[model samples]
Target: MSYRSGFITIAGRPNVGKSTLLNALMGQKIAITSPKPQTTRSRITGIINDEAYQMIFVDTPGMHEGKHLLGKTIDKLAVNSIQGVDVVLFVTDRHLGKSETKILNYFKAISTPVILVINKIDLLKSKIQTDEIILSYINAYPFKEVVPISAASVTNLDHLKEAIYKYLPEGPQYYPEEMVTDQTDNTLMAEIIREKILYHAQEEVPHSVAVVIESITPNEEYNTVDVTAIIIVERSTQKQILIGSKGEKIKKIGTAARRDINKTLDTKIHLSLWIKVKKDWRNNPNELKRYGYQDE
Candidate 1:
């Protein structure tokens, strides 16, 4: 029997369903997802172990133009993750445009085989339309295999998995069989909190907010975990928006985040949130490091 195992990086533009595709592939949520652009700010690794192979998937921040220091750091993180991987899953949708040319050029410099994953085929009206979109990519690069899938609907994912497995080289498992992701509990909790803020708050609030879990205490007898976290914002007005009138908005955010945390941790959750104004923490190197956005 032959075994296959290797690292695979998923790279694409923002809001292209990169995180959604990752959740579907893992059959669980390891990365956070929201309708907002640039939802993913770090590199998340999900592992799939089966009798035949172990596929390590790296879900990276979407490659884009950086408008600020934080944005630049995230873009760099996504780009750096592509190298040194056994394969690359370049995910994109039907709305292919000139901005994608830069990404294609990046792939040209890498020796790794890239599976051009044309995601969100469900949006297309017909097979002909789908083929037309795929052709544009085909003309640009020598993709090892081009697989069209709707990551949201879990459509054609089996074929995507098959394509990945076919290209993976034989090797030993990189993680334990029971392990699904490399992210720690704190990171997941903070992300869940951030995800809720992205969903509940107004559009502008999502980009300004960053959640940092200060402490997590587990009560074995109660089968519950209590979490304390700080939500960092750039301005005092943004802080007011997050906290809301009489703390109603914060309460709503906590309720939503706690529900998801309970499911992820398989325990009762008590989440405490605090809003703090950091006055441009994104550009401050020390603050960025404190918030877990480190340069590679």
Candidate 2:
């Protein structure tokens, strides 16, 4: 059988379930997801290897209007990811809006085929609602395929995969069959920690937070990994919120993060989390670079 492989970029606005779709498509959780907006900060590559094809999916940060240097950087990362890819999945969970229009404008300049993926269809009242959404986007731009799916429920994903496969070009496998993602262990650990915060933290606190793995030491005697992570926030109040009264919140975040890391990385881990204040770090270019957001 002939082999096929290509890169597919998942582009969308904030909180539209793009990351959830990526995780569902990969059949594993390489990408961290939450109900919060701007949860994804960078491009995450997930490789799905089948006997006849290898589909490399790049999950980009949500595209949105930026209020700070970090937000603008993330928007730029998402826009740039759409270029130089074999196919683009413009995911949206609702009808035409300002964000979708801005994304469609970019599609006009690029020749790459884009598939309109209407996510969260399970939330719709009826098939007519889904059709209305499909009509709205199709009228705005010509999509190669329109597939309505619910990423959270894992519905219609097989159909979506088939649609994606149709656009993949014949090529060699870019990654090994056994490999799933391109992210390093430390990056994954840090992201996992951040995901926990997003789930536990509320309001602006989650958006301002950044998690960095300080060190990862393996102990052969106990067959466990010792991980120390620092959680960065923009204000002292945010730190207090993360730490909570008597450190309860931080403990909850740490415990949840450790559980996920142990399962996802398939290794026992002793996780230690610390909170730090870096006043308005989102606007500080140096701080953004230090947190691995500027260089990308």
TM-score of each: 0.97, 0.97
Error of 1 at 136 (Å): 1.5
Number of clashing residue pairs, candidate 1: 0
Clashing pairs in 2: none
69 in model 2: Cα distance from truth in Å?
0.3
| Model 2 spans with C-alpha error above 4 angstroms | none
Query: Can you write out model 2's per-residue Cα lDDT over 1-296, one digit (the tens) per residue?
Result: 68889999999999999989999988888989998899999999999888988999999999998898999999999999999999999999898988789989999999999999999988999999999989888789989999999999999999988998898899998888888998888999999999999999999999999889898898899989899999999999999999999999999999999999999889899998888899999999988988999525
Given candidate 1, what's the lDDT at residue 194?
Answer: 95
Q: List the residue pairs that clash in candidate 1.
A: none
Model number with the top lDDT: 2
C-alpha local distance difference test of each model: 0.90, 0.91
TM-score of 1: 0.97
Per-residue lDDT tens digits for candidate 1, residues 1-296, read 79999999999999899999999999888999998989999999999888999999999999998887999999999988889999999999854587788898888889999999988999888999889999888788899999999999999998998999988999998899989999998899999999999998886778888899998898788777878999999999988888899999999999999999989878788888888999988888788888998545
